[model samples]
Target chain A: MVLKHIRNLKNRFSSIVSRIFRKKRDIRIGLYGPVNSGKTTLANRICMDWLGEEMGSASVVPHETREIQTKEKVQIKSNGKSLTFNLVDTPGIATKIDFEDFLKFGLKKTEAKSRAKEATRGVIEAIKWLDRMDMVLVVLDSTKDPINQVNITILGNLDARNIPLLIVSNKADVRKSSTTKIRNAFPGYDVIGISAKTGQNMKDLYGSLLKKL
Target chain B: MNLKIKFIPYEKMKMDSFSDILRDVKENTIILIDAKLKPEEESEIIEKTMESVSEKFSGIELSSIDFAGEEEMNNFERFKNIIIERIIGKKRGMTIIGPAKIIHKIKKNPKELLLYM
Candidate 1:
């Protein structure tokens, strides 16, 4: 128990030191979440809104993003305030990956196995990059239940690292989506409901980003 | 197939460096911890699981339920639980971790964890 507190203190100290040193470096805002939670869609929306280009492809299939994709020099202005930062789109994090699951999506056996392997690597990469993020936007599907181990672990790690984050309750355009449920699940955090597909409530997101960073 | 369930105290988990836990998990054992693992510990376990992932061993299904906020506790009970947790440096909860192959899913509710095989 003492060791746990010591580890937490060490994490806080390292977070502070990193923040102090990162002032001169490029700010990296990462999009992270569970599998198929619309992270890449949000990343693409942000890029298209500000840079007039898309960052990455969004797909119905999970783990479409098998590597970390970054778009540099994204500048957004909202309410007369502008901020420029690098947007990093990370592959979805999952605890288990089975090739048979991909087969259910109509993928060939070989392709499914290959994708599963790459996804495992991608999960490792995303975890490793958690320490490098200046801030994170935890994208979650508002239509699904928010109380899960993956969400808890992600939020917990961010809290331990002292990294600023905003819980993005995405898929707000869906009829069954409920941001209130998400807020209830994770209290005491900034949560915004948005639809990347329809460009809904993006201005508020930008304003929040400008204010937070 | 026979199933093995190991009950491990939080202190022994820390002392054993989680190596034993991981090995038992790979050998098809379900692990039940007396306390909810810290977030850092969970992340460390995930990292280790990824490193150990193979064609035979995929990963784990993990879920935890803490008494705080899960049930309607009186203010006094809540306060006592908080104080006890603060003094012990461990949350009053339980964690169940099993190999993903054996445990297909572990659905978490506010008060209980439903394991699917």
Candidate 2:
């Protein structure tokens, strides 16, 4: 009878351990930036490294991402805790153009105007959603000058809302890139230099995000 | 000295007039036109805007120069000369081109201009 009780206790303990290991915690992270700033590349890299597959493709065309794309069920281990993340990749924000401007891209004047209006609204929606995010990653192109109107506007809005942000200086492997300039442009903010193509400094990026979260 | 710099966007300007606006600007004050306008258009608008102030400050001597495409060194020289000759000596001020390249050019001389960015 004592031997039978010991075997039953071992089975119960194994069941409890399996239940705990099977459970997953959800964490939502938003990726945001201006047009052509490499938000998609970062998202893809994160997914590939952590999830073992690319979440999406990266394009050179401006506003290639017309809508928000999300990759869910990504499991990441941080601080000895297993957490699942729903990575949200958003469309690029650009100046609103009129119907005539859209027609230049081969759309009907009315259609172009409507699309432009939607694009404008999309940007506002994405920005407003920042308030609901657990964390935000603001990707900046290191090759460009740090003083851009769009960047300043985005940074100001994020700062005003007091949202926790990580400035990811993308394209670090490119020649003539100045990550220092980017860090200086926005003071007192956490900035990381990462090359998504070569996966350089990505582990550090993940570690920083885990720490912040 | 308290220098008030008012940056008026180009889209907001009415009557394309600047002279009447400059009449109210205090001496040693900086008027920054924070607009993405063409160089020639900005030059013409600035001249017409500060015409009244130029005449009133005849004793102060207002000398204006337009900075279109000068390099960093040349731009700094232009600004330094304007401050000494037009602003201090004449007691009247002149309007430089927009975008504030003068400030940026001067910043390069320092080891780190990141603090200001």
Candidate 3:
């Protein structure tokens, strides 16, 4: 049972108040998406740009960050614009976490099992933390299909909670990157194309993030 | 329609009876249900699926209508295969039962109730 915390409710209330008053300071902005979609990469980019440091390490293996990592008070100054908020880089959300999937990547049985367990817990923790977020950056891999079960479920959860969101189409540097498909998959929502690794179109992302706030 | 079956251990379950878990199951949906008995005992499932049977699932009280239909009464051989192939004689396991599309729909809805065998 991944129930919402009372602390989340209080934070949401204050966040609603902050948005109405146009106050961006200390706002909880979460990065949510599927595994290996470059959420940690994007988080690191933002942190590196403003704070001169990275929040956590990224891995080629799936579910590298199984716990929520936060970099607070990241004051972004870009394109002659600025906004200050807490960057909550969360674990990737997966509908299914099979140890066998990890085993295919050459992990030992025991290590695979423990990683699966931790990833499962991380998913639940991510959902519980959603209530505390005033806004979310729904990062998606532009090279993959956007209509996947994980993406739909993430969007559904965010919609059910009525949270404000901006879809960050990550990995646009890849040859097959297509933000149009993502826009079609989720119409009426703002989608921005950016290469978190190469820093392509990052200025547009900054402008969009400010609009979402 | 393709289907998948998985096993769930009742020892760690919070429910006392199969009906307790059955109450949260939605109608006309493909689902994994416990099917460990011999094919002959397919009759036993009849008792669990009776329209009049009611029980608690995860604390919410409901009835069998929430899970199955009389149509299931005719699928003994299918259930038998699920038992032999998936359960492999394990005293406890689950069988996927329903239209492939509905089952996929259930799987996609992350908020849907799942004993998730």
Candidate 4:
């Protein structure tokens, strides 16, 4: 217990020191969540709205993004205020990756196994990049229950690291989507509902990001 | 296959290296910790699990419940719980971690956990 406290204090001290001495770099805003939670979709939306280009492709298959995709110098203007940052789209994090699950999606056995390997590596990469995020947008599928282990762990780790964050309840266009449930589940955080597919409530998302940072 | 469940006290877990725990988990053992793991501890476990992932051992399914944090409490009650946890050196709850191959999903209800095998 004492060691845990000491470790936390050390991390806090180092974070403070880093903030004090850190030179001017592009503010990195990262998109992170569980697999198939629409992280890439939201990333594409943000990039398209700001940089007039899409960041990456979105897919129904899990772990479609197997690498870290970054779009630099994405500038968004709201209320006459402008903010430019490097937008990072990370592969979704997951605890399990059974190749058999992919077989249901009509992938060949060899292809599924290969994809599983890459997905595991992607999960590791996403975990490794958590420290680099200046701010994180935790994109969650609003149609699903939000009180899962993946969501809790991500939120808890970010809070422990003292990183600025905002929760995005994506897929709000779905009839079953419920932002109220998400808001209720995580009471202390700011959450905005948006459909990354149809670009619903994106203005509110941008405005919220500006206020958060 | 015979199922094995190991219950370890939080203090003992802190004393032992997590690799020892992971070794048991790799051998198809389910671990029950006396208290909810802190976020950093959970992250550390995840990192270690990723390093050990292979054809045989894919990964682990981990879930923790903080009984105190889950409840709606008045400020005084919450403060009292916090003090108690501080003195106990652990949170007031349990955590279950098992191989993902064995435990497909551990669903979280508000107050109880339902494991899907």
Q: What's the TM-score of chain B for every model shown? A: 0.89, 0.34, 0.30, 0.95
Give the better candidate number (3 or 4) by DockQ: 4
Model 4 alpha-carbon miss at residue B66, Å: 1.1
Fraction of true A-B contacts recovered by candidate 1: 0.54
Q: State the weakest 10-residue window (summed lDDT) of model 1 chain A.
A: A1-10
| Clashes, model 4 | 0
Candidate 1 per-residue C-alpha lDDT over B14-104 given as tens digits, one digit per residue, 9 for 90 to 100: 8776667889998999999999888888877886777777778888998888867634777798888889899987888899989999999
lDDT tens readout by residue for model 1, A93-154:
88788777788899998998888889888988998788889999999999999998989999
Compose the digit string of candidate 3's lDDT tens values, residues A41-88.
999999998889999999888988999998889898666778889999
Give candidate 3 misplaced runs (Cα > 4 Å): A1-25, B1-29, B32-117
What DockQ class does candidate 2 belong to?
A: incorrect
DockQ for each numbered candidate: 0.57, 0.02, 0.03, 0.57
**lDDT for each residue of candidate 4 in A107-149, tens digit (9 for 90 to 100):** 9989988888888888889987887788999999999999988
Worst lDDT run of 10 residues, candidate 4 chain B, spans B46-55
Candidate 3 has an lDDT of 0.65
CA lDDT of every candidate: 0.89, 0.58, 0.65, 0.88
lDDT ranking, best first = 1, 4, 3, 2
Off by over 4 Å in 4: A1-17
Q: Pick the candidate with the highest lDDT.
A: 1
Worst 10 residues of 4 chain A by lDDT: A15-24
Native contacts, share recovered per candidate: 0.54, 0.00, 0.00, 0.49
